[model samples]
Target: MEHPARTLTARLLASRSLPRTDPQVRRALVDEAFRAELEARLAAVGLQLIDNPYAEHVAVALADDVHEPVFGAGREYAASNIGLTRDQIALLVIIWALIVLPKRERQVNRQKLIDDGQHDMFGQEAPLPHGEEVAGSLSEASLLADFAPVLGHKTYVQGKLLSRLAQLGFIERRGGLIFEGPLLDVLLDYRLLADRIIHGTLGEVLAQAGHPLPDSDGADEGL
Candidate 1:
């Protein structure tokens, strides 16, 4: 009989990303033995599971241990494995900060409320908030106005980078709004990126534009 771990691993590679609610994905999340087997299989090829409780999708990435061997052969390892230019990376960070930081805060709050409501000491814990349920869309026009100067002007951002980001599964654009895509939260490290965005110069720019980072003291770490 074919092992389920192999099947699930193949599915993940084929799909690039899958929702946490997917049957195979949910099984991988809850079944520790199964997950370990899956991880072992992935690590054979120098890959690792990219799973985050706060994010909606699960994906795979090159393992950190093998990163130097893989990406450092011919060129100085750049910020991304994909061929993203510096400006594109900057624009991606801006959009991620605008959308994900607030969404995570809401998810944490909702989970807290659920925990408070459950009186049974042994009650099964509620699932983490789904991205679509807590995430807010960014107005493309507003983003263009606020970040055009730094992001290479409105025409360039609108003409090139947004389309590329959308193609790369980082965002989805519809009706003049941008929604988080499958990889937005999966590929990026939230704890690393959030701290930098919330405390760094970008925080000042966002605040000036009336979209300040939400206040939180250690709540971010809880998630």
Candidate 2:
């Protein structure tokens, strides 16, 4: 049996190839049964198929329910925003742990460290002093540790994941530091989506890493 989506897709593509002056094609284009089937198939994936009388084109859009998840509940974030894979989500959670969370902790700990006179052999008490300088990057060793649960201890898989994320504008490596890139900021805008990708998709990996699931509010604050 031909799938409804496939049938609709074929009809739309066929219509595009023919001129509007063709009588049979014009009738098929305006057929109620064809229109209904196309709309029904699109609705199955949370989309709407609409005819534009003013133009010779059809506009397919997200259904009201899909928009509701984005503007109302905040649960369906990733589908609309930044695309993330399971491996990427694992890397993001690790980045959150190494960079975002620690930056906050470092600010609170700075005063205490200074008060306690914590200093290195060179007599420098302040560690980097700047949040981005200190916590915005990670070392390969640290990444390996954090990524082990998801990508495993395999160096090749780790390298591929890192390369893929970097290619996708998620991370950037300079010298020994791995900094969050511009795409991370976009991901942070949809915090609920990021949290869902992390906790919902990577629950076991997160548990193994001893990472706490993030609260919906302010989860993506520092990213």
Per-residue CA lDDT of candidate 1, range 73-112, in tens? 6665566788887888989999998898888888877777
Error of 2 at 130 (Å): 8.2
lDDT tens readout by residue for model 2, 27-58? 54568786566667668777665432211234
Quote the lDDT for 30 in model 1: 96
Best of the candidates, TM-score:
1
Q: How much lDDT does each candidate structure score?
A: 0.86, 0.53
Which stretches in model 1 have alpha-carbon errors above 4 Å?
A: 73-75, 118-124
Give the number of colliding residue pairs in candidate 1: 0
Using lDDT, give the best candidate's number.
1
In model 1, the worst 10-residue window by lDDT is: 117-126
lDDT at 10, model 1: 95
Model 2 scores worst on lDDT over the 10 consecutive residues at 50-59
lDDT of 2 at 56: 25
